[model samples]
Target: MARLPVNHPARPIYRVLSGLVGLYILVFGVWGTVLTWGEPPFARDGAWALGLRANLAFALVSVIFGIVLIVGASRRGNLGHYMNLTAGVVFLVTSILMMSVLQTSANFLNFSMSTVIVSMLFGLILIGTGAYDKVGPEEHAEEARKHRFHPVAEVHRRR
Candidate 1:
């Protein structure tokens, strides 16, 4: 059971950042999709969009993911927290998985080193946003703040 901040002061900023990342992903996906139109889903034809190598398959997936992120960011509940966390992990894992097969035929996403780096960066950002975007009642928030530096004592007190 990990403890997270409640009603964090920087919540708005994190939400905005999350939205921006989603916008970038959406734009990249749309551009990539148009550029890779009429090509094979996994073609290695060297198409680039927003500095990331992409193919039809990857582009379509990005579109969906981007939409999800945007929706999550726009929400005013914990949905964004969960979504960001999940997206962050997914991005991180995908970057590593793709990087592993960078030069092999298994690189169906046509990922380049740049793509891996960007994905990793996005992952970390999303995770950070998720960490501090939780919302709760004022009382809970006050308790959280009081225990911010002594979580063990807080847990014991709760028990």
Candidate 2:
């Protein structure tokens, strides 16, 4: 049985959008991993308590989410969508919480910018991808794969 109907309209858009989000996850994973070990920004900050808390919180969240997406994508192939959806929700919730915290802080805009950018961008991308996925057809995905120079599936010839 096909996973999606043949006439679905969102297949191509979903594939591309999700692919972009997957790329972003991979890139951010690498960036966060590198930052975790190197000379981190919080290291120089005199406010050790809040700085350490924020740094640890950010690192932990990134590591957890990154691992989820990477493992899901590599192992399950299509699970990246669910992983990204969850990640987007997490970003939105975290952004809201951080924004509330910033409301009473001195560096309100500066600190909030990172969370706002990350939340908004990821939310938009994931929602777009999800919307496309809702209309995507499995048959079209297969056809698109056939036309590609680098097909995703292993081609099996005559036995």
lDDT of 2 by residue, 8-116 (tens): 3655555565555555555554554454445453332222221222333344455566556545444323465565566667667766766666545443223444555
Best by lDDT: 1
Each model's lDDT: 0.93, 0.49
Clashes, model 1: 0
Error of 2 at 21 (Å): 2.6
Whole-model alpha-carbon lDDT for candidate 2: 0.49
- lDDT for 37 in candidate 2 is 47
TM-score for all models, in order of appearance: 0.91, 0.50
What local lDDT score does residue 55 receive in model 1, on the 0 to 100 scale? 97
What does candidate 1's lDDT look like per residue over 109-134, in tens digits? 89999999999999999999999999
The superposed Cα distance between candidate 1 and the true structure at residue 126, in angstroms, equals 0.3
